[model samples]
Target: MHTAPQKFSRALTALAALTLAAGSAHAAAPSYVGTWASDLAQCKVPQERPEAPLVLQEKRFDQYETHCTFSSAEGAGDEWKVKANCQVEGDAQAYDFTLTVSGDTLTLTDDAGSQDLLRCR
Candidate 1:
């Protein structure tokens, strides 16, 4: 007992809902979900000695060797933010960092400065 216009409207509404669900399902994974090595040159780290590589393992997202333990992480598109407790020198510090990734390159920004890293193969 539906008019042509009513049927069309219902179909349009169903299509819209399906589109929204598909969009959510297609959300991209966080780009920082892998191991990265400091690009000493781009990061401007002193050439005296190379910096230790960083590893962001799955699930827990614990960055090995960097002394960073992320408690919460959120990602939207290519951007990610994490709240972490990290050991700097010998002191434990709370750090929040924003990261952006493009291709094999990732840039991490924090209170100090931004550093560029390359994905580890």
Candidate 2:
């Protein structure tokens, strides 16, 4: 009832499925999704800090009293451009920020200026 060719094809299909599953199992989160701070000491501060740690999610970020929800983020592994509506000191504002990451350092650039941060462990 079973032909050699059919068995070979089935085996190949199973192998392909196994390979895909293995690859996906080892997939990692994007490099930009993490907590970053000015230094390790800053990581011990509150959830996020104005001049220290910055907590980032896929579509939002928080630093001290500043909370931002971004509409879109465009970029690759270690760099991204984000457009967000944020509340800073109780005032609403629109902001566009550029984030670049290298090793443990994260550099964020905005209308005001650029600041470098370290990844929190």
Candidate 3:
């Protein structure tokens, strides 16, 4: 009799754990839907006197929270573009950068081994 109750408790615990896992997956990644400007100090390379600011346009698609991506356009005389999936993990939001995130920043490494974004607005 007692064994039956123990099993029921275990089952309930498992169900709760699964639900929490799924919730985190949803929470970890969020839809990107705003215009973010660049923070100069967050960049891998500092901007020169004659350079324009970097701007990013984050858009969500199909109302799916996890299926959103961001397109970044930098103002460094030439047309530079970077793409990444955006998400919110715990208390921090990240752009993924196709690689890593440091603090409130995302690092984009190109084929040429260069970090694309320093800070996202």
Candidate 4:
């Protein structure tokens, strides 16, 4: 038969294990921390105009064809609000965009419209 003190010790040990497991399970992925490629089909783009792949770094976004360096990006719920300076076709412009991620898919919304992108492998 286990003594009262022995049972209490086992209970405390189990509680600690459960706490650690819960903490790890609730840990969330950082906002916009991966490479994503546009799903042209999902965006309903013309076959002739293929979208480029996008790679997001700590404070920069690179689309192979174009590059943008963000001044700030903050997470709000499932979305991130970003302010960036982008260079395209040799012209630099200030841009603001919203990014939302769900599962393996990410949606970027700007002045044009929303474009869905899949996480790159």
| Number of the top-ranking candidate, with TM-score as the measure | 2
lDDT of 1 by residue, 1-121 (tens): 9999999999999999999999999876577777677663433332233354666643233332346777878876678788887775557888898888889988889889998889876
* Order by TM-score, highest first: 2, 4, 1, 3
Better of 3 and 4 by TM-score: 4
Task: State in Å the error of residue 45, model 4.
Answer: 18
- Model 2 TM-score, all chains together: 0.76
lDDT of 4 by residue, 9-121 (tens): 99999999999999999876565667787653433332234365677876888764567998998885568999999997668989999999898888999999998888766
Q: For model 4, what is the error of residue 63's alpha carbon versus the real structure, in angstroms, after optimal superposition? A: 0.9
Query: What are the lDDT figures for the candidates, one per model?
Result: 0.71, 0.88, 0.42, 0.78
lDDT tens digits, residue span 84-121, model 2: 99999899999999999999899999888999988999
User: Model 1 segments beyond 4 Å from truth?
Assistant: 1-29, 40-50, 58-65
Clashes of each: 0, 0, 2, 0
- The C-alpha stretches of model 3 lying farther than 4 A from their native spots are 1-27, 30-97, 116-121
| lDDT score of residue 104 within candidate 3 | 46
Taking all chains together, the TM-score of candidate 1 against the true structure is 0.57
lDDT of 4: 0.78
Return the TM-score for candidate 3, rounded to 2 decimals. Answer: 0.29
**Per-model TM-score versus the true fold:** 0.57, 0.76, 0.29, 0.62
Instruction: Note each model's CA RMSD in angstroms.
Output: 7.0, 3.0, 13.0, 6.5
Give the poorly placed runs of model 2, Cα more than 4 Å off.
14-27, 48-52
